[model samples]
Target: MIIGICGSPRKQATEYVLEQALATLREKGYETTLWSVHGKWVDYCTHCDYCLTNKECVVQDDLQELYALLTGAQGIIFASPVYNGGVSAQTKAVMDRMRAVVAADKNFFKGKVGMGIVTGGDRNGGQEFALMQIHTFFIINGMIPVGGGFFGANLGATFWSKDTLDGVKLDEEGFRSLKKTTKRFAEYIERYGVKDGGKQS
Candidate 1:
């Protein structure tokens, strides 16, 4: 199954692109699901080492469900809006909490394929840096990270704030290209892909 972990609120391009990615995955006979962590007050980690052994978080919040999604999916498509050259706080918190997954199983994220999409406010903006933040997590977690024929495909070069904030319009044209990249990535991972330094369960 292919799962999308979206950390954006409202119906932004993340939702649209993620939906399209899932649709394409479905067309390819792959089951898919979407999980959004929008508007939720997910707190940051407290520098605790609880997850390194408990296989879960000490705090009770959205992370409980997120941990299951992370471990159960065959592939993960993660998306977030670039905020000051990085992922949003909510997204970071969720990713940060992944320590629990690591603590539960040393190789918990092994062999899981990951794709990160970041929306930028302007052209050639912090796209790469923003993606790096998420891709770094995948790298350290032993997940295979895929990009647009490179290492991190741009969801688009830029985003129109007016259209984005309104949620009435999305980068459909950009998503069309991104859809191709995402589809090809999904297939590659499914057919002949494995997580870096990890194994498939």
Candidate 2:
């Protein structure tokens, strides 16, 4: 399944863009799931090393459920609103808590396709930087990161939400980028299949 994760605290522009991407994947005949971090209690990683022994997070929260969904997903699209030149706190928290999965298996996300989307309040509001940070996490986890082809989305989909959901709709370039990125991600998943426990199936 293709999983689209929106890390914005509000169910506005960020979630809307992520939904568009997920819709594109679904239109391509891929089963997709949309997950929002809004109202979800995903705590920051405590660095307690408890996962090293138990292969699970010690903090009791929604991350446990997310872990299962992430592990079973073949494609992951991570969307976040740019905050102070980087990913939002919620997004970072989710990324940090991924350590639990890493502790369980170093290559838990290996061979899965990952794509990033970032919404900014301004045209130059650090969208690229946020996208880079998200892509970096995927790379570090051994996941394959894909982007829209040449001309646009050199990293991934980027939207200038201008602090409003409707503003994102006006950014036609952003919509195109999201569509292309999602298309590429779906194509990759179909071509390579999904890797589970180091085996592609």
Most TM-score-accurate candidate: 2
Off by over 4 Å in 1: 150-173, 194-201
Could you tell me every candidate's TM-score relative to the true structure?
Answer: 0.84, 0.95
**Consecutive 10-residue window with the lowest summed lDDT within model 1:** 154-163
Q: For residue 93, what is the lDDT in candidate 1?
A: 82
The local lDDT score (0 to 100) that residue 100 gets in candidate 1 is 79
Clashes of each: 2, 0
Instruction: Show the colliding residue pairs in model 1.
Output: 111-195, 148-153
Off by over 4 Å in 2: 193-201
Q: Could you give candidate 2's per-residue lDDT for residues 1-201 as a string of tens digits?
A: 888888998999999989888877778887888888998888899899999999989998987888878877888889999999999999999999999988998878888889999999999999999999999998898888998887887888999988999999899999988878887887878776474524442
lDDT of each: 0.69, 0.87
